[model samples]
Target: MTIPSVKTILYATSLSNHTRGVFQHAIDLANVYQAKLIMLHVLKPLSDSNIMAIQSYLSEKDIQKIQNVANQETKNTMKQRLADFYQDEMAGKNLPEIEQIVVKGLSRYAIVEQANKLNADIIVMGSHNKFGRSSATTRKVIKHSGRAVFVVPTDG
Candidate 1:
């Protein structure tokens, strides 16, 4: 079998254990095809109503403090996770340009938008095998993505 020349690969992850498998796949493909690897994590935005409801339960100062703490923790966690993944799995390998991106938005939409912006040749994503029905997000990505998507089964 011939491997396609993957110039750029986008790996969308939710920081799940399953996503680690997706990352591994992306790394292997990147090494094989000499493709740039882009790691993307999307954070869902809290709605105004949701924020208001949470704020109502606490003093303004307390709410601000909590929000600041949460934001800082999230940033730290993401940075550490990305660094660990790279060091443990991707380091010492002749790989293409590797970039990590963290964006706040809906996961699937954010991934599709980034893929388009980057002109990615392939997207590697992990999927759970309980296939009763596809999620709205999954359907949307399948419909809208111009690039090919390689779904790695989480359970497999």
Candidate 2:
């Protein structure tokens, strides 16, 4: 059988400090294959208090304005951080096109959904390998993504 070449790689991250160790694998693979890297960070929905505050004190336009600014700032920070990580890990060599994404939702569902939406050739992520084999999110994505999943063992 002929093996397929990877075109796009989705690196689903938890944005945890420990996961930094495992993130290197994604950068290495992307460099080796020269594939586009989609860096994704999924955040759980904001606290009830925050949501209530938005509804109570903020108009629709005001909410949008505030949230949009927050979102853009978050995007910029994530992108810069990931870029720095890649650069530091690889010594600024063989960098790939990296797209940073942030969204609020259930991690398992959001990750698989994004992978499918991006038509990613592979999904790479870091897991603590807690529950027998991997974390809950890792297992769910492996089962539901319908794409190749690479789970890097992080220093939990």
Candidate 3:
């Protein structure tokens, strides 16, 4: 089948230093295709067991306090860093509409679901190239995405 003209691209990131290269690649692809860029950050949800375990080690009040602090810190960090990156990318270029999405769920599944929902032409993400577990997770995402995925090597 002929490759369709990409009109929208999803750039999935974890706001990690290593993922910077992947964001750059996404910007380049968006520029080339003149496509809208969507930046996605998935925050893995805290399981009930995990919450209960934390509560067991600390008072309920203390646990709530810690959880709130952690969540706020994460949100602030992601927001500031992503804002700076996006601003820099669009400084003097005719950038397409860029949307930032932050959601709580499984990264692989959430990312794939968002891509499908947004009708993204392509999904670009950074890979740590970890074997075994990580590879398996990536494979699952690729299999279920039903869209083009470009995995950029973080080490390279």
Please report how far candidate 2 places residue 91 from its true position, in Å: 2.2
Q: How large is the C-alpha RMSD of every model relative to the true structure?
A: 4.0, 2.9, 3.7
* Model 1 vs. true fold: TM: 0.73
How close to the true structure is residue 76 of candidate 3, measured as C-alpha lDDT? 80
Ranking the candidates on TM-score from highest down gives 2, 3, 1
| Clashes within 3 Å, all models in order | 0, 0, 0
lDDT of 1 by residue, 22-135 (tens): 678888888888888898877788899988898889888998797677666666776787679778876876656778777778877898999999999998877652342334
- Taken over the whole model, the C-alpha lDDT of each candidate is 0.76, 0.81, 0.79
Q: Per-residue lDDT tens digits of candidate 3, residues 1-156?
A: 986799999998777776778888888899889899998877787899998888789998997797677767776876787678768765776656777777778888998999989999999977663321244445677889998999887762
Model 3 — TM-score against the truth? 0.74
| TM agreement with the true structure for every prediction | 0.73, 0.84, 0.74
Comparison by lDDT, 2 against 3, better one: 2
Per-residue error for 43 in candidate 3, Å, reads 0.5
Flag the better candidate by lDDT, 1 or 3: 3
Question: Model 2 clash pairs?
Answer: none
Candidate 2 TM-score over all chains jointly: 0.84
Best-first order by lDDT: 2, 3, 1
The CA lDDT at 148 in model 1 is 89
